[model samples]
Target: MSDTTQPPFSVLFVDDEEISRNHFARAIRADYRVHVAQGADEAIDVLARHGAEIAVLVTDFRMPGRDGDDLLRQVAHEYPQIVRILVTAYADKDMLLQTVNTGDVFRILEKPLRADKVREALQLAIARYAERETRQQRLLAMSETLGFLAHELNTPLAAISLFARSVENDVAADYDPERQKDIGAAARAMLNNAQFCLTLLSSFWATVHKSGGQQSVAEAGGREVRATRLIASLLDTYPFAGAQRDWIEVDVQGDFVVRTMPNCVALVLSSLLSNALRALADVDAPSLRLEVVDGSEPEIRMRDNGGGIAPEIRARLLQDPVTTHAGNGGHGMGMIFCNRIMQSFGGRLGIESTPGEGTTVTMSFPGPRNRL
Candidate 1:
């Protein structure tokens, strides 16, 4: 909560003027670890020595040799996670726009920087830096998990699949002719489990690491992916593929395409499929259907015949991390991630259901461009 409690987070202040630097550092040094630079060159040296320790970079523009713009540009390229703020006396609309567009600078303060205003901006910048650190930590954890999954999960999967088939063959030879089908069915379930494990292992990593960067930033005009194709593919080969896989069906009413970051959609669908399978466990005549409606507003719908959401669960389903499977270690991040994905693409994820009846989850994007 306070810098005194933990290791101080360092903030670099770059200004040619000694008076300004000294005055500004005194304002916020109590809250943050301060590192002052006389000019752009010294700032570079300081950054090189303490880049890992430095969280915030506040530099004054219009320096003697190289300006704040140059320093911020270097920070953007080298330490992209660092929070960059530019302090300037002069203003050029184009310069500011370019710096902001390239994400080189987070905030711009006028030359006569007040302690109060600078402190406020620094606080926000530090918060941003903290968030970036958190994201990097998550990415690191996910990478470690994925790195080990190939050995830890796949090895056990091989044993299960092989042993299940061997048992089926051995048991079938000594069993009644009518019971042969039962042995085969049990063996098939085990094989399905193996397949599910494989799919999850591949899909989870692929979905999370789409562009293969520390942060996967989805570009506009991504390769067009069809809604029906994704659904059909998942239905046939998904983690939830089991006896209920036969009941899951896909229907494409007309031509429809999701033209942006389809991996996000795939990840969301995987989460939903897992939930649907869990809900259908206690229901009789379980069924899951995927339907894509093609028109002005193309929509992908997932309808599942399972025990529906409770009144309280339905109320705050997307609003918060509220899961019915709390006892089973469900954190409710899956649905939250799904909602945010739709929101990112100017779309809406709507859910409707009755207590006993099924649930229908609809995904409506900001319609496809051009006529088919």
Candidate 2:
């Protein structure tokens, strides 16, 4: 809402005592759209009806049926984004801390609350609520953008890949060996490009779905992924590695089965592959190898024989947004994001590198003690 029309971000002042509740609302109503509730039950009703409009909630600790903690706890669980302030006369610091920690109460004020102190607390609470709203709006906008890009690009990509594959198959069946080699190479190129687009689309879809608050679909939290298929798919679909497809090698000792989300794997590996490709760009006879270990750990190791990172940079490699491409549009949060995803999957994301030697990023998921 516009600034002029928007009633100063709303606040709900709740107290069982009539004088305190009326004073609280009166002191704040000049600067804020204040709503007053007599007890916990009325507070609940007010929240249910005007939760979206109310930015901050200031409640007395000693209410009739339920205390402010109970109301704050319910608010924290159901409407976590709302800012909560507890007004109390209780001298228990530990209890206040607990309520702050678990119930998500933003501020605590003693019973003899001054108008200035209460306003200060409400200001902080309002700021926090505004911050949360801005963050959610940004996420929603970005998710919409991702959804749009994924939808637009996927259609054309699907059509091209379908047509290209059909042509490749017809050429393979009709062409002779001599001319077939060159045509086969061309066909492979098209197929690889198509695969790369498809892989990226998977990540785009996952991101869009996640940001849109619909992350429970595939529930990639469980481990039931086809290890080899996921690996092979990532290898074929990754654009950076695919551009230099011949430079990268895959060495699978045996069939390694691991539990992880295929899309998660794709996204994590895609980030690693991208970094490897960029590192191997200017190296003489560069090579990026994908090794799936089967011994003590089932690990997917991406080893690149490119220029390694310097000691200073290596120290905070994945911990920070340390990037070699600062001038470009890269935000350098790729590794950070990848590392988080790995951790969420109960996997270890490790990295080793030497200047001028190379870099190897290993992603190992939790498995049986013997290792799959």
Candidate 3:
């Protein structure tokens, strides 16, 4: 709808007395689209039928069927998007105070309703309603954007995965040991990248589609995940070449465990591991090790012998949209997403690197019983 052509904001006035209802309706008719209800039941019927079009609710406190306070409470719970104003003569100080505390009344006016006071309430209601609509629309737009990115990445990734599996089986059978190993390694790398893309898509989709006033999805919950179990699962699920596997090692202190959403933690760990392996592509002696320590808090240390990140690139890569297309395949989106995951779980992701030496990524989370 064009801004200039949009209809006046709709307002619903509920009062027990017909005279009061008509008086308030006539006062704001010029500035608002107004509807009047004789009692609470009638007002609910109007709300049920025209809730989307109604932006403001003006109800009187003294009604035979449903009092103004009762009506406003219903609106607050059921249609909070509609700003509520109580227009009533029975402004008992305690009652008014209770209404405000319960979030029922945006504004309360004494019963000798003046045209000016009613109009002012409507004006403020319209402004607040507009602000809420803008925020909701922005959230919806961002959610759609994330969904679109996930949909776009799915097609190419699926094709690559299919082709990689065919090559891994067919090409490995035809080559000698040395050449076969190389071909297998290349195929596994392609497959791993494809799997990473797929998992990321799933996570983004889940986060965008959460329900019930929940703004976003937190890390998955309901499972206790140990570092060793997580590492073993990732190794079995995603393909990694001999060189990649040889350069990486994982060790956990006895009985170390973290309370977290298993899948989210796994996704973060996989992303970090993938980034470390990508960094090691040209190292003289590539090696990555993960050691878990159980103390006041559970800590995981991932260190690599690969050429460490450059000082200039280190900070940038930690942020979103990391691009290193000129070098071996490197996209910093993984680490950026991992950082968000850690923060969501009340944990921290730490990075340390020295030029020409190596990089270490540490993830710290609550140990058993929320220790340190």
Best by lDDT: 1
Please say which candidate is ahead in lDDT: 1 or 3. Answer: 1
TM-score of 3: 0.50
Residue-level error in angstroms, candidate 3, position 269: 0.8
- Per-residue lDDT over 1-372 for candidate 3, one digit per residue giving the tens place of the 0 to 100 score: 455764668899988778887888778776777888898889999999989989998887777866877888888899989999877566366667777778557888887898987778788889989777755643543443454345335443764666577666767486677766666666765766576676656654544454222332222333456777767876666547556787777777754665544455666776677668767888878888888777776777899987787777777765756644335333445555566656654677888888889999988886556521
lDDT of 3 at 204: 48
**Alpha-carbon runs more than 4 Å astray in model 3:** 1-223, 323-331, 367-372
Residues 88-204, candidate 2: write the lDDT tens digits. 886756667777878877888898889999888988888888678655644543443344344334443664666577666767686677656666666665665576666677766
Ten contiguous residues minimizing lDDT sum, candidate 2: 211-220
- Number of clashes recorded per candidate: 0, 2, 1
lDDT of 1 by residue, 155-209 (tens): 4376566667767676858667666766676676577667766776666667566
Off by over 4 Å in 1: 1-194, 205-210, 213-223, 239-242, 326-331, 368-372
TM-scores, all candidates, are 0.50, 0.49, 0.50
Angstrom error at residue 343, model 2:
33
